[model samples]
Target chain A: MLGPHAPVATPEQLAAAREAREAYRGGLVAPTSGVAHGLVQANLIAVPRDWAFETLLFAQRNPKSCPVLEVVEPSADGRVEPRLAPGADLRTDIPAYRVWRDGELVEEVADATAAWAEQPLVAFLIGCSFTFEAGLADAGIPIRHQELGTNVPMYRTARQCEPAGRLSGELVVSMRPIPADRVADAVAISGRFPAVHGAPVHIGDPGSLGIADLGAPDFGDAPEVREGEVPVFWACGVTPQAAIMASRPPFAITHAPGHMMVLDVPDAAYAA
Target chain B: MLGPHAPVATPEQLAAAREAREAYRGGLVAPTSGVAHGLVQANLIAVPRDWAFETLLFAQRNPKSCPVLEVVEPSADGRVEPRLAPGADLRTDIPAYRVWRDGELVEEVADATAAWAEQPLVAFLIGCSFTFEAGLADAGIPIRHQELGTNVPMYRTARQCEPAGRLSGELVVSMRPIPADRVADAVAISGRFPAVHGAPVHIGDPGSLGIADLGAPDFGDAPEVREGEVPVFWACGVTPQAAIMASRPPFAITHAPGHMMVLDVPDAAYAA
Candidate 1:
């Protein structure tokens, strides 16, 4: 469904999304940004049923960082089909997947069918900031990372998340430099899409969140904070992956950074 | 943490809330409506760890009816302290508790210490309409049930909720008679608190929702539709209870209707 603020996808945009998903399912590995316009791209995380409760609870407790779009419980036959996309098999659809063993990244694979078949895994499709980034760009706010052709800067803050069961970790945030005058506008635009990481958690000072230096981030490329710009920080989706590492679940799977699962659902579907 | 729209609670109101909670813990049995002027009250549901994931997933899928405020995982000693109220025991804080066995209401108890200790129970504190009702009253919208001194009329609708695991049930809604002129005001006021059941689900016709008689309802009292007034329906918190009955978990616990767990957090804490 299209939202009032989001334009309806053109036929070409729809075809691009469908083709991209087909290519990924066919074992093509590549970054997904800018591949499909006006469609929602999701971060994928799958864990065994034994750890699903804790993972789901952790997301519930820290919704700002983990905005779950859908949770796909394996069927009696142990097949997972995310509701966001019909007839799409999660096992092999994402562009790339990271396999973790005891919280350590063991390998990266283009397809995860074999790993998925090993256990009854519950898959979570979490909202990504790409949806709201479109909203921000539409409102004339400059996204520094996009202009620089680099990854968004992410930092691990000193703020401890509300722990759920055994899963606990520090809050992680992604930073974007917005013009001083457009900071409020950027917040209002992104806040409309709460299902994605909504609104800036911190506006002006990174040090306040225990981020020692904005230039040296824990993940992603350094940001370009031009003159007359303020570094605005939004809760990062990496927070859940950080929890998986901190809590050290026996096994887990996630999409490699920048390699996302494109959904059939429109970006506007997540807008408030 | 006072919200801009919400007024700060006076000393007497704060005292009244504290006293009401203490009285309930000391064996007083009464409805909790109007007991606390500006504090938040919550709906309680405690199910064994076996059924927790399904229940939590059900709430996530059907958020409008079952907005979860906090989930309390039992400690090693089997003690549950809801984060909403520090140092408060869920087993004895509420005015009344209902014990369910295989989806059937087996007994109503004043203190649930025995029932709670029967097994490891994970307690979920869900949002209640009482929080938004304060907003409605503040906006000068009349709440008919309050004037009639009867429970809000609730009905089982034809719409089925999105099933989660073993949980599946029809959507249940509460009805309030609002003057046609102020229906917009009522919706706007309540929509501000999404943590509770937010805006009206239906506005004018009962037949459209598959309700045959306004005089009869599946739960709560029949309504008084005055002249120039329309029946407005909202997703009811009773939905989760209906799902519990439909799905028939082996054992469950809930607060008696209209008897709630009072929390220390201000109502504004939940305001958007």
Candidate 2:
């Protein structure tokens, strides 16, 4: 893989994403920003088999924010199947994993074999925007946060996701300001990738979603909206984190923000 | 409301669905097939609050077969508020309810108050094809089973639903034979109503979905396929019943196949 933070790779490099997964599994502990440009990048969430039912429901109920690509059940021999990666190890494919206990993040580790080995755990690979952003870029629309070299601005919206079981929380959204002329193109492009967070949930007026300040966000840096550009918000994968904080399960794991798991599938596989 | 086996109501009659709800509350116990022509019809599934998490997950995991319109948690005063109906008492809104204990159907009753009163129960209102069938009829597509005045033929498929907790079973699909020329129109019509078992899961061959015979089905009666027609299958709401049987949950409640809860919202409201 190219040096960390290199611009998004070419189609050929993305098709050969096993190298990126190799970099992660072989102890490269950096955020997976641009490792495999045209492949799926997943946000990770792991919970014990006992808690797996509700957590999976949490993602399923809020599909916009948590479109699950595949769930590796602890009972299924816990093998990392090819829906994402053919030979990937669910316990260590990501660059980093965060361990949360009782709603508090307690540890960030390069691998989670220790936690996973003790008890059967279900690993959920939720769709993230890396593939859709690649689609957006290919469609000639620029991604603001990537160009700025910062995390996508995310905010907790007033919109409530349909509650399922013990998991319920406000929908969290990531913002990208596209030129007014390109907003339709942006929607058309992103809408095709529903497995990733699809079309803009809200297109205008921050207050409508209860986001107080465009300059201040609940997570990530402020977005840079250009003149004649509109802020387009898509459901963010970080929603599971907010849900975790609210539901307060005893044990959980997630990928550190921006440190995603690079999957082996081509991004085109996710396009609707 | 009309008697059992009444003709499908006119649009104006559907607009007055509250009268149907009243008939149900006033001890008129009959299947609700023709009660409200243009309103939404839902399948009911109730489990204790402790089992709700897993049951909800099962629906979320198998959305095509079990589209949940609303979930009334026992913790929330447990009164049903249909997104489609206001001031509806879920306990009596449906004409008939089936009680299952240890995976066996033990009783069919008009009122579940006696069972529901003793313990907190979470009721799940699942999407059914009443609205989509209306769309199909409007599009000039034939609904073979409905035309024959029989239940839609349902079969156990080889494709297993993504298991959630203790709920795992082969997907159950309802079959309809649309004229070969109109299959596209059938899909286009049903695709608009995502809330009501959107679109066909499989088309053309019953064997593709693991149905051994078109003349024989595991649950519903066999379907009659006309010349120049193709068998189209949509995920059936009976899926949860199969899951409950497979998982063997201690107690559960479901609507009898032909009995449904009529909601107040217009069918058009569910169109995408």
Q: What part of the reference interface contacts, as a 0 to 1 fraction, does candidate 2 reproduce?
A: 0.14
lDDT of 2 by residue, A192-224 (tens): 887788788889898999988988988777889
Computed on alpha carbons, the lDDT of every model, listed in order, comes to: 0.83, 0.77
Q: Pairing residues by index, what is the TM-score of model 2?
A: 0.84
lDDT of 1 by residue, B151-198 (tens): 778888887888888988988888888999999999988888878888
Docking class of 1: acceptable
lDDT of 1 by residue, A1-272 (tens): 12234445567767887789899988898766656866888888899898888888989988888888889877776667876777777888898998888999998999998888877788888878777887787777876777777777888999888788889998888888989999999999988877788887889988899998899998778888999999998887778888888889999998877678887777777767
**What is the iRMSD of the candidate numbered 1?**
3.8
What's the i-RMS of each model?
A: 3.8, 9.0
Worst lDDT run of 10 residues, candidate 2 chain B, spans: B1-10
Best by DockQ: 1
Clashing pairs in 2: none
Model 2 over residues B1-272: C-alpha lDDT tens digits?
11123234455755568888888878787655445667788889988767876787677567778887777654367565665566877777787888888898889888777767767777888888766887787777877767777777778889888787777888888788999999999988899887688988889877778888878887667789888989988888878888887888888888776578888666666665
